[model samples]
Target: MPDETVTAAEPGVGTPNVERDIEDEEEKEAEQARDVEKGGVPVATGAEEVSGGKEERDPNMISWDGPDDPLNPQNWSFGQKWAAMGIVSVFTFMSPLSSSMVAPALPQISRDLGITGDPTLSSMTLSIFVLGFAVGPLVLGPLSEIYGRVRVLQLANLFFLIFNIAGGFAQSKGQMMAFRFLSGFGGGGPIALGGGVLGDMFLPEQRGLAQALYSLGPLSGPAIGPMISGFIVQSIDWRWIFWITSIVDGVIQVLGLILLRETYAPKLLGDKVRRLKRETGNDKLYSVYDKHDRSMRAILSRGMVRPFIFLGTEPLCQIIGTYMALMYGVLYLLLTTFAELWVTEYGESSGIAGLNYLAIGAGYTAGSQIGAWLIDATYRRMKVKNNDIGLPEFRIPIILVSAPISVLGLILYGWTAQYKVFWFVPDLGVFIYGMGTLSAWLAIQTYLVDTYTLYAASAIAATALYRSLLGFAFPLFANQMYAAMGQGWANTMLAFITLIIGVPAPLVFLKYGHKLRERSSMARKSRIIR
Candidate 1:
């Protein structure tokens, strides 16, 4: 691969200019090494800085010390890379766990808090957390770009821990809602930034498995939470749900401090520039990020707003975001309604109904593990056929298979429960739905990361905003939708909608995705794939 560097030359000027004489490869490598020892690569031979009416060129422009620098997160050891992935995965798990942990306890909480007349308010307590999820990434994702990933992530986790612990002490519906929202706000950090961590640590070729492993946290947490909380809410006070999760989060925070390291290359190089300026008394030491004269506020404002811009302008983000949102919405809808389906239809206790969630968890795990292997293998096979060049479109084919499975699962789940048939039949449908949802999730996430390598966090944050909103709003109307339409038809409605939205997405990307990406401003700025 060609060196991924930021030269002062205009875009597309430095590489593959056949009309210009190519420099000697060995001599160029040797010169780059000497430049690294001097603190940074020069801006370019004739590059001039024009800040504040100054016309002099600054020779000290910082970047990675050649492609193999150990400081670069991409070059980190396998043990270190996996360690970072694991820590972020743990952080990712806690938020989704907390989101649905309160589901089984909602009735008890409603009764204890005297939430009478309207069950909507009670459901609000559970769904309001996802509302926070929708809003947090706009600020947190950009903050990661500016401050660094480890710092932002650890601080956000601490924020989540504090608010979540406070939730245990709530005496009123208002207090509980406030605490849950704040906790969720903090929880959004890992979801927004975790993709960027994977993008930083692994090449596109190796990201499939890492993404699949990381995905298990968010996908399985919602399924697993209700299972554990069901028993806890039965035997223990409902308040212990918050208390126990907070304690687990505290432990994860400590692990984060020990294991997580700064992965954003710009932030790392910026720090290096600051240190060199202090040690050598040279104010001209700068980085490519410093080429512009924007203030911190301006930079943050732009960063915070970029996700919305991508959503509006980029077809890839729009299509994937819509599909992921539908999948997420359905997942939460199932989480909210599955237990009720069992209790009301099958005459099972809350605890027994909650056990059905384990089927969903099992499907998620199996699907993620299998999808990981399939994605990596398929990409490798395609790369070999294409002369070792990989495209983001290689990630889309699996979703074509998974989407239909999800639609089938939804249909089966709805009809089986509506008829009040054998209990295990509905469970089997739930398991299938879980597997299908997770497989599609793995493909979408991996595609986004590969397509928007440098801006992976922002792209994911944009997609996540749509997803969180759908998750928050879908359950609010779920009971009414199911009551009016009946379980069989209601879920069939969802299945059809899923088919309409989900089926075309992968096929479109498979055929025209590269063309769409070539025209995207975000994709052009990323300049990582080509």
Candidate 2:
């Protein structure tokens, strides 16, 4: 796949430069054709015509016509790229919004469904959705590779819309849990595939802002959802939460169909091959992704298993996955606990307490906006320092800055709330924590995308597997941990864990990322295809 940042000459009709560029590109294609022939692969010089009236293509081989093909998603215009980014980001936001939006409605749901005996079941109604986040990516990420990002994403979202609407009408606890899980499974599509979409649309150097905007969806959605859900649950009914989200998702679904285009290179090229085969009467036409003996089952199996392989074998994936999981776990923990702290500790109403979540949302907005500029500036400066060569490590400095800031915010929040200090103090702490987490998260995401490149969906899914699990489990245990250990000590422990994970990760990756990539099978595969 061509890097999205690499611009080719835009030729106008009858221009000498256009003609010369076309001639040069044709000569280059001829050279590549000759190379293919030397390698014992049958070649077709052009899709429409070839020497001696017809040409035979190697069924096992396919590739782009040199590097400047306009069909490549990377070659799309900036407006087009950003439009796709915005659409995917919206898709990503809707899922996490649904995940946490039901929090305020859980109590009502429990009463309505007669789920009073075990609180865990009520919590499960909320957290099981997150479990879907963990599971859906394992399959959906790979499916996106086999199919295309837009199709899988849109289909999964439609699946989500149906189940989520069903959840609003679920009569029993069993039905609600089933509906929520299925809805979450569908929602996971955007979370799993959004990174790969961005990877397809932007170059490494141009990815920071795009990633920052994309990252805001998942990071801020949980916070934003509850704020809206709280008012809805109080003013209307608990069921409206699901209905509202379903309605919004329906809107996003329509927009996606209208705006989203196929971005996957292999998938696009495979379709081209099929079209060419039909038009030119060539059965041998095939894409690089195709194999003479490959079956759909083999492709699905490989795609499904690759994330696990990455998680199990890649040291970078392991470390980064752990770090991202911890960050996500803490975020959810805070989300679950913040309202309780405000209501129980400070004696605020539920609606008023919910307003405090705005602190985190505001911080996310600020961090993403600021971090976008910081990441872009840092990457560009480091690239210049390294003779215009960018490294994945360029994304790590923000992590370093964020580690201490996050720790400080955690401590301030813990101790201030424990002492029943000014409300603004704890809110400020929450704000700072939000900023730190968002900054770190954006850096980690960009780093993973840059490192994994073509396999970004799988890599992100691998990490998301751990992260979403922790996101689910942490909240389940948060109240107990705070009760058992007290707010200050409990948060202190979390802060210590955050520091321990955050500090060493960037340093290790900065020093050894290249060596690690060199030893990685996935990385090698990406290089060969590129």
Candidate 3:
């Protein structure tokens, strides 16, 4: 089958002045903003386009004016690009914070709500939020593809804020459950949409640091959320947790409106095309992205099912999603169990026990920064060695280094805890594990974006589905598993599984990734796979 996806920014060789440099797209953004204010969009009327003769151009297709068009997000100024990233990171951070902040408050909530004996209901209040994570991405990720990212983000943030605040006033567990799920559904917008934004803003070679920075919110938020809340639940009412998150989310919603613009090219170009037709009285002008009959029914049908289709049909997505699921599952497993370890095994107070999560936070920070330092550098070097061409495979080599460390940490933490070793030792092992998992996770995230440049939202949604499901399911079985096997043996079993998944995943990409991409209809088109 021929490639169906068309991006206006893709370098056009046969056409004159079609090549684009997203790194420094000139000042056409100012023109685009001005045109928007005047109720239209600017055309690619560069000096080259005008001088090359308009008669030779294809007036039907709308694209950036050469590589330097400032209107392209890739060509935006460094400040603007980072500003977008920073705001999105904050959005991503708040959701995960809300997910775990209640962990420390669960006991208090159980008492207040008269569910102190029902362990299952108490856990549901915490884990049910993650279920929404799985569901929201399936719908919202695709909607962001159809609508603009900024519009969807602003709306989702507002949705999360309203429902989250409602959770603070709930009198029954059922109401709290419903409110939490809806809040998580709204919060899912950032996690689902953030990857696509990075894909839009950065090239394959430039994605490592961006991926690393964006990941900190997901990885570190869980670690930090309980640290603060342990103290809150100890001193104040459980309702404050929900109220505080809502306040922060309201602020983030405003920031998103102010800082985040439409990053998805299809949405931006589609809007521009509609404006063009209205202003010029020519209904024929359309963008390459405006292919097919894109009615609301068709868009919704395609967008809603795209994640399931990718997971079912794409082998590459299946493998990546499974690995991510296991990684995320283990992370949640630890998050659910870690406090108990400190409070019960080590005999620490609730507030003090929560502080141990800082170890994981430090490790996560180390992992993200390490990935920033290593991933793109490794990709660039490997690409140069491969005759100045790049492949998504170049992003996987760091996984080789990260996988072993993860397994080692699992063993260390499990056995040391089993033997009642020094408190610091188990914390050290947790740190190492955090560093390893986040590093590997960062590489895989960037690889997916690089591989499926156009369909990144759908691709990520596939992984997010698995990640969220595993995150929700793992905590339910964690205590039982540890009780049966003991920490040492249980961790050893987990390590073995990690080793099985982690060791070969990267090597497969290194050797056969190009071949895999050859079979993927939705992946980025490359002249040379290697």
Candidate 1 weakest ten by summed lDDT: 18-27
Candidate 3 lDDT for residue 420? 87
User: Which is the leading candidate under TM-score?
Assistant: 1
lDDT of 1 at 118: 77
Cα lDDT tens digits for candidate 1, 1-530: 33333222234665433211111221232233333333434434333357798554345767777667898787899999999999999899999999999988888888988876776788888889998888888888878767889999999989989999999999998999999999999999999889988988898889889999899988899999998888898888899999999988898898889988898776888898899899999998776555443355654665677687679878999999999999999898888888788778898888898899999999999889888888989988998898989988898899999999989999999999899889888889988988988988999999998787656787898999999999999988887888999989999999999999889889899899989977765565465423
Candidate 3's error at 483, in angstroms? 2.2
Q: RMSD in angstroms, candidate 2?
A: 10.0
User: Which residue pairs clash within candidate 3?
Assistant: 20-67, 21-67, 26-68
Instruction: Give stretches of model 1 more than 4 Å off.
Output: 1-58
lDDT agreement of model 3 with the native: 0.79
Report model 2's TM-score to 2 decimal places: 0.87
| Runs off by more than 4 Å, candidate 3 | 1-57, 524-530
Candidate 1 vs candidate 2: the lDDT winner is 1
Question: How do the predictions measure up, each by TM-score?
Answer: 0.89, 0.87, 0.88
Considering only N, C-alpha and C atoms within 3 Å, which residue pairs clash in candidate 2? 4-74
lDDT, model 3, position 214: 92
